[model samples]
Target: MGRREIPLDPSAGPVQQLAHALRELRAKAGGPTYRAMAGRSVFSASSLAHAASGRALPSLPLALAYVEACGGDRQEWEARWEAAGRELARSPRDDDGADPPYRGLVCFGQADRELFFGRDDLVDRVVDLMGRRRFVALVGASGSGKSSLLRAGILPALRERPEGAPRLAAVRVTTPGGRHTSEHAARLTTVPAASTEDVLLVVDQFEEVFTLCPERDRFLDLLLTALDEHSRLRVVIAVRADFLGRCAQHPGLAAALRDATVVVGAMSAAELREAVVKPAANAGLIVERALTARIVEETVQEPGGLPLMSHALLETWRRRRGRALTEEMYEAAGGIRGAVATTAEDLFRRLTPSQAGTARRILLRLITPGEGTEDTRRPTDRAELDAASPETAAVLEQLVRARLLTLDGCRVDLAHEALISAWPRYRAWIDQERERLRLHRRLTDDARTWVEHDRDPDTLYRGSRLAAAADAFAGEARQALSSPEAAFLDAGTAARDHESRQTARAARRLRSLTIALSVLLFVALSASLLAWNQGRSSGPRPRFARSGPCLFPPRPTSPVKTALPGP
Candidate 1:
């Protein structure tokens, strides 16, 4: 039996009134113990008991979990919880100078675990899989909170080390890029192997291996080899679902993932509510029920919308009233659909013409247009931009400051893939120049391959392809080309022109030979006709000499007349 709880005075305050209502709810349902309540919800027994303690307002998730376990109407309890939070916010306490609990465009990390909610069940499942498997694939759509699940959810849970689990010597998180190698994989496992303790290596954005990495096969082979050789090494890869087929192309990875894959899908209504309201409550702020309802309504139907919801909540928090995040602020910030667009467009409109152009180039460079999959963020090198230009530098800095882009070391990438579909202006830019962007991407890859082959002439473009590339990259568009790509195009153009000049010279020589042959033939035919005419004249002289004896011929003709009369 549970300990007897103190009765709450309904008239005391909002918190007390809420506690009294919960008690009455329990009574109406024939009063289950906190242990029984915990079995039905994702909360602890003590957490269920604390909701009715009346010492403070319970978090919306906790209150809802309590109500649901007790067979009470969740919508009614959620409203009551929001009211109590508002009353508590109105009554001031000493300021602790806490930072905003909500993460904007960025994902939740281990540091933000206290404010992270809504994936408890998912975390447990992943952690359990990790206990039995050496390789686990966490696949999800873009903006579906897979990264957060890995970092904030699974990382924290692993650190806590449930019951008999082995202690991790190290946890390293890396995103595969253009230059990954076997050596990189060796480095990740070195420490754990030496210490004879398990290590967790999380490969986030694993799709980059296909999109960006040139040594993807070598890298993948090394990771699989490490797992096979080292019993202490564990690998967790978070990849977009669209890349699952790509992973299947690798036989070793396919075998490992057949049974060791965890798929993150859309959040349920209850989960979404916890994701929206719990963070604000942790930061000592009230989220108006209307605002919560509006946010949930906007996000529930949108698949892979966690990032949009987080960004919207962050924007609303910025424009929050003294202690409450109201529906008015959410509307003002443009809600889930408009928040990212509003922020991006407003920044773009403030730039000068040249700066705006630079911004466009920078943003486009960070995106890799899709072939059969959705468009994704492309991590770029700082050296790829024209660092000499002040506008280029300024636009890059401003974008990083705005959190629309992220700068890590010499690499720059879009803050999230959600930005691709969320901002209309950026989407239009991609749509308008998608073909050109694809051409540029191919050129970039070809340039890298050319350098890899020591600039072999056979690798250079020729003929019609060269002509098309030259036309497409003419004028200002050429500035988008990297040094290697520009060099490649120039070499291809020069080679094609040289081939064309040689062809033209050969054509002229053939024309001259044909003219000479025709003249010789005409001369020979004229000579043969003259020879025949001279021969005929020399032979006819004897016949003409007999014409001098005309008189004798006349006498013969008279004698011949007498013979003709007899006939």
Candidate 2:
């Protein structure tokens, strides 16, 4: 009634051995067609047949379902399936040189549109909002896939516009880094008057404007003004949800975001399935159903787990056997929670002592320590790195190759903010030096301000602030400082020392003057007392003399010498 079952050779391999065992179990229960077993179980007939085909190991659930359908012991079959999985994991496989389907700790770009999935509905809603409103804010938590949605979802949809929609003249995306200025905003927001097609501008990581950029208000004003003045200009800004309050500080920007904000939340189970399966399928690979279920179950419970899921999937893909990504590989890659930290720790262990120290400095420099919010990735200029040192450059190269850091032209930053919280060693580094990092951030800002003001003396650190900077940045910590920051600290310290020397000289002069004045005052008092004593002895004498001739002498006698002689 059904196609002949493929014969299995028990001595071939673990897969074949398991397949043969499954067939014997079926025979013991009185052989039945896969269709009959499928009717008794939840799996399809094709899947039941494939489990015994011995082409590859079926997922544990599928294998157990087959066993139970054939009146076999599910517990025994599960053990057999697990044993086969272990044997398969141990077998070495050659690299296929295929590109990974997932973007680990990195946002999807236009080129990755095919591999990006699961945000279809949200993307449509955002596209509709963008079409209706001239300004829209995409708000979501860190690692929530907002950037990926914008780049891989909305950008592609906009380019492939539906019939009767306004054609876009240009679609420009920019991030406002620490140095974004009003001039930069103006350049980004400007629209040609002669151009008839609508222009779409996306500002990704818009929170950076509030956190890093000094001219945040001006940048917001320019964007808002562009929207108000040009009917053809549409602006979308993707910001971390925590920064919505900061955006509200500007009334105009707040009003625009009120009705036009798209919130990216946790992906549903079905969406997560699509996100996990579709990418692997596109790459001609199979993600085991059990692995998919496990990933969905674990990731759904964790808020902001999209990036972690992507990274874990990427790591698992790296360890995949043949064309199948299995649970064994996922576990070997440390699952979702441990995957990132494991990779980071592995890289750290592989580095030399000097290289490890440089790696620490390099990684620490790529983060912007949050004030009231979570820490974020800071894009540093390659020039800012100690690339001159061969060891430092090697560390940077290693990190980039490992996908922990990304190098974009002259800029370098962590591939994602997830790395800051995902890796325990990195997180510990941040926590242990949080106060120092804050001080360094201030020192950096002050240094830039000083340089901008032509190295004004008044801008340099002084007094207690200078002392704090000096203390915190001493020894190895000083290696983290940028050229400008080091220069700023050096200049400030020099100025402070100069002031100290002048104060010491002035103090010495004042002390000498005080001692000299004290000696003169003592000498003058002694001389005045001596003059008074001399005057008293010379000018003042007793006006009366007494004679002791009788028991009672006459009072006030002009001369008492005769009376004294007679007595």
Candidate 3:
């Protein structure tokens, strides 16, 4: 539903107008969502989405199905379709394929600007604020449209610099994900055409520096240095508000944020309406008034629910009929609350058991266990996954295609943090392994650090620390570990056992030596007594002088004749 855009090239021909008219019927019918259409009609949602896609003329039966799903008169729409076809403008250009208005979990990109809506004010504020300041941190909750505002809004706005603005050099946008800082710097530091006015360097998803990057302190130092090295360099980082505290730990970032932070929040109802209606309208489609109100009301309740709203709209779009998204469609897609989870669970259950297990580990890697903090999505390297499973790429691609997981270049991450709470199975997994997961993450960090420090034996786990880690891996959730992590655990356990065995051997050697010395003393004492008896009268030779090493206690070598006088 989310992937289908409406009335592609709507005004071009009667066929296109017929498609446009079809969209309007659905709009009039309270914008029945495409999901609803699929549920109520014989056609699939994808089929329905494609029917109006303008790629190929839909079959008459399909057209009738579309009208029927929208609660329209089939006879009227059927006759109307024929009439439009009579003079149908056959412009070679077809609206065969179109993108959807709602991005779902996908962040708005430069190409998606035309459909990005509802954040005009936020976008303007960001550009205006960063236009003057050298450094500005844009903060917002997850799914608050922060990435969209930066990507679809500010970047284009900067490119469209207005009069009276000072701009000479280039604009460089990059993410500080571990893999790219050096590249970002190399590109960002280059002065374009001898102009030093300002180079706008945008680092989106700045939180990844902590959650995903291994070189946290080093990356931060490099970034801060870049910001300070030139006054003409303007740096803008779009980050989630939850990580603001982590950001503030750095003195330079803290000072910059003290006065130059812009926090994006939920939009008002009017803004939400604009968001819901404007994109479809722009595409020659109408949104039902009731649908708009319903989306706004449901979205506002979830604070940072824009992602969910977008996804729901996407689902609704798929189920959309003639010209509109309807309440029935939204309900069919499980409303705002159920849509994302439903989609995710469906994907999960369809996988084979082995692939499903691989997926769980893959997803668990995507999360950073919060010791005392909230668990959040972690960006992971595809290489780590590759080491774990040969099937990694295929599973990764499937989830990425499903939008449950996203793969950007070599990196992989869950599309949104909301997925953590939205999916029941995911929540259950986290609950069952909270403590163990924390330990697992810590062990992974320690192992990496150990390798970085030349694999020092001193850094290896020992004693209780070793036991706890081993015990954790032996637990039921051990399968959740990546291959390297499992190997690390196995290596550490081996080292511990080796150390314990060496200590045990040393203790045994010492015990044997003590027994040998005691026996030698007894023999020496007996020999001394024999010499004394042979040299002199065999009276109990005057007891040896008392000293620390008395040769032997005063005991007879032979049984005493007067022993226990007939007791």
Candidate 4:
């Protein structure tokens, strides 16, 4: 049998290098076609072909399968994969730091503990509240380091536990969102406490219960019940401060807020300085004194402005001429007010027009309704986007890793709602479609109600309401509607069109009746006039004045029965 030839790009970076190595293994096996390999292996033939295509790196499963099929050493291939990952991570970005010191839009994780600063007092207060109370609510403005404090500060502090202090056992962190509030609450209540000393349930983004989940009160009720049922479980919830009024509506949470609510506000000037100065110092970079003073002076009045400061620092670091941060770099990043928008807009403009359009759509999709009925961040699945287009897929990954969009598991979301209003481009996009989105939101709510009522059809949008939704459902917003909403709108539209046709038929019948009535009246008037004319001409002229028609005349009574007398 003849051997099939496959070309390789030798100097095309680590990805191509890995592809070359894979092809060599195949060549050693007499270069079997992808079809033959798929027949033997579990991986698909197209997947196998793409793995060796020298375009991008293959996933571990595909790579491992290829290595095994070609009989390469597993240990060696795994090591190569690790090396590729390292090289890819270190690959220089357009901004020059793929792993920048500052995180933009994304919250700091445990791994980013060192990078998280400025919330020392807030964290301590929360820790104190948690120490004294069984239930503690950490409420803060969005982008005010609520998640960072919980993950980086409180959790770590609890783990340290002052040695032999109730010995931390099982700790689970979850968000109450998207059809999982009950399940998440269940995790807290149904903990395996026998194996552990105490269970810690850290619920981050607790506001999601109200914003994303429908049975919010039910979930809250269940949570209160769980607290009563479980002794070892200590719960800590982090909710955005904007939703405090929403929290008050839930009696259990409102009662909990009677004492245990910890409000996190903007960090003081000194703290903001530490936040900016320390992270760079740890990263072995220095900020100019003038820059620090300028930042602190400008940021003092701006409440909940830590994100702006951090993002500006990140972009400034990217534009750093050397070890020292400069004034020009900060300006180029659009300064404090414009840093996030500037960077985001820059990323957007750099994309091809089509890809740029796709990016807009992806960002808009991340926006779900907020507690205050404003647009807020919603985690969307990455698979919802078409990965078939390599360009679109690449942009999705880029935006996410850039921290402009936050990705967790297979899901993705805007890191914060602040981005919606902070960025001019995003703000304009939202403003342009505000009316449409409003209608879409109403439709979504009504449709959900309809389903909750077992598709009761009355909740469906009809007439102008359906028309409005359909009109707004154009372009990208069209795809944003849930399946139920789209179905409701469709059914409503059909119903409205049918009603319109029936109305048109009724109008046509009324027009015909009106025309017949007018014709009968005209015929009656003509007959009456003819009878009077005959009487005036056949009978005497009443011996009146010589006029074409007698104005006033007397009739001869004796000649009234002329026909009868003749008979």
Candidate with the greatest lDDT versus the true structure: 2
Q: lDDT by residue for model 1 over 320-390, one digit each (tens)? A: 54688887677767789988997788689889998998899889988888889999899888877765577
Question: Candidate 4 lDDT, tens digit per residue, 1-567?
Answer: 323446777675777888888898888988787888887779988888888887777888899888888778889999998777545433323444345678766777777878777777776777766666677888888867788788977777667674423344777888877656676677566657466566777888887787678677767776565256446677889988778888897677888777988877777889878888888888788989999999998777666676777777777776664477767677767778888887787688789888887887677666664535556677765654554568768899878766688778877878766687778888888777666656655675687677778877676777666777778886666666656667777778887888889999999999999999899989999999999998889975545666577676776667555455554
lDDT of 2 by residue, 272-322 (tens): 999999999988999999999999999998789998999999988877767
The residue-level lDDT of candidate 3 at 160 comes to: 83
Q: What is the Å distance of residue 561 in model 4 from its true position?
A: 39
The list of candidate 1 runs beyond 4 A from truth reads 1-98, 164-166, 181-183, 191-193, 226-231, 452-454, 509-567
Better of 2 and 4 by lDDT: 2
All candidates: TM-score: 0.73, 0.78, 0.74, 0.66
Report model 3's TM-score to 2 decimal places. Answer: 0.74
For model 2, where is the 10-residue window of minimal lDDT?
88-97
Arranged by TM-score with the best first, the candidates are 2, 3, 1, 4
Query: How do the residues 1-567 of candidate 3 rate in per-residue lDDT, one tens digit apiece?
Result: 345575357776666767777777777888777888899988999888777776556878899999888888988887887665433321211134666777777778887888888788887777777756677888988888888888888888777885433364777777666545665565675666666476667888888777767666666665565457445666788898888888888897788777789988889988988888988887777778887898899998987788888877776776555577777667766678887887787689889998888888788877777644568777778876763455777788789877788777887888888788778899888888778777877787787667677777777887788788888878656776666567677777889789779989999999999999999999999999989878787555455657477776787679658856665
C-alpha lDDT of residue 191 in model 2: 67
lDDT of each: 0.84, 0.86, 0.76, 0.74
Clashing pairs in 4: none
In candidate 4, what residue range of length 10 has the lowest lDDT sum? 89-98
RMSD of model 1 against the true structure: 16.3
- Which regions of candidate 4 fall more than 4 Å away from where they truly are? 1-98, 163-167, 226-230, 369-374, 383-392, 442-465, 474-488, 491-567
